[model samples]
Target: MNWDDMRFLLAVAQAGSLKAAARSLGVDKTTVSRRLRALEAALGRQVVEVRGQGLNLTDFGRRLHRHAEVMRDEMQAVDALAGADTGGALGTVRLTAVPMVINQILVPALDDLRATAPGLRLELIAEARDLSLLRGEADIALRLARPTEGGQSVLARKLGDLDYAAYAVHGAAGEMPWIGYETRMSYLPQAAAIARSAAAEGATDISVNDAETLYRLVCAGHGKTLLPRIVGAAEPRLVELPYRHGALPKRELWLMLRRELRELERVRLVAQWIERTLAVRTSQAQPTRPPDHRDNGADP
Candidate 1:
């Protein structure tokens, strides 16, 4: 039997009378009666009997009502799933970033993100290695370098530069040893710059792959190491070295995402939050140069 007719049958069976069923279905009693008769004719069976004050369902009608109930439940389940899939600002957004940035920048600003987007959940992947946005590994990514190869599907935007400086423990003096990245990370621009400076001064003493470990080593008076200005500035014991020691190349931070996700309301909100938060933090950490300063015919 047609599902529409079955629906009318179920409604009439539950409501007991055509008038009540019509009230529930928002239709007139005569329309309900006509539809119920059509359902009975389609099944070729007398499914209802006219009782003194209401309609009573026959055994076949009761059986059909049970099947219709099951179909209604299944349809409701499908609609619920569809609604969840289309929900705009409610769901998990996976974000990936380097460990240092996650620890120094994203972690401190998470409360702001949660306050602004209470319906959005965050799944953070903190690692130095880049995760694949094209493979659906992450929804948003914060990287030190702009991606060179994700094709048109990838959207990359420069947020700001991560400035670095040599940090030494408070009250340390004399020719200090230097800490740097291990051989595995020597290809990093910061590492290469530190290595050259250390070699010229004969100051290399230790190497480590992780930025936190390097920071800790420097704090213990092991040696000075290049650290992100934001991290170094927060530590009371660490003092920034003068620029004359040679400047390390500042790494540009880029926000990367899949092009399709750029328009998703939740993702877009998170992206804007990250951009604003990092911009504020970076400005606070770096020293502002005078507008009048010019270097080699270029603005400094």
Candidate 2:
């Protein structure tokens, strides 16, 4: 008689018992009995019978069950069609970021972005290698460290400070392992601080460059590295190093895009998604000092 009656009849005809039907419909047995009685009363048909063994579906009940199945399929089709017109934006937006942020921050917040833009697609480049926006590398770049010199200028937004604190794998800080940078780079601000700290603390040096590799080296219980507290805290094994004297220097991370495409839809979506997703991490990275994350928190 109605959509609900059809659904109840369908459940009952398939389950064959009031108790079983009630469980399938997620309602009480009494409710199922009441609805069934009402359906039969309104239709003037013997839809069910109580036997010595249990309940049985009458001929009319079987007929209703077949139609109910068709009805369910029709309802599903209607729902799908109605939902087709809903959603905000669409299209693939390519984005690039350092590995630490990708692992610790961005990866976790993607589901929320999906909810915001159901048809939105994201392509993430997680390597440390600088991808060129002018050369078609990425629609948006999440800058943890300074951009590699000589790419192309773009519209940049300072996400926030990437707060750095001297950290080690638990007790490894006592034995300072200064993570150094790649060869051919000049003295960076953080490396300079670390060198001064090592000198001040009278500790030996352990050099490393790549941020991802440095994190791995620290995780293996090797030594301490000046890393973004927000990113490093995500790894369960690593612990903040005991500060020798003062607070470690902090570096502000920037979100950059192609200078020409600053207003493009794809770039805008990607940038908005990145800022919204990493806002908390950026906020956590308060500017306590100077820019030191030249290579995403790796020593200089």
Top-TM-score structure, candidate number:
1
**How high is the lDDT of residue 47 in model 1?**
81
Question: Where's the lowest-lDDT run of ten residues in candidate 1?
Answer: 290-299
Q: Which ten residues in a row have the lowest lDDT in candidate 2?
A: 286-295
Residue 231 displacement (Å), model 1: 2.3
Top of the candidates by lDDT: 1
What lDDT, from 0 to 1, does candidate 2 have?
Answer: 0.66
TM-scores for candidates 1 onward, in order: 0.64, 0.55
Overall local distance difference test of candidate 1: 0.75
TM value for model 1 = 0.64
Clashing pairs in 2: 167-241, 180-207, 180-208
lDDT for residue 223 in candidate 1, whole number 0-100: 80
Error of 1 at 138 (Å): 0.7
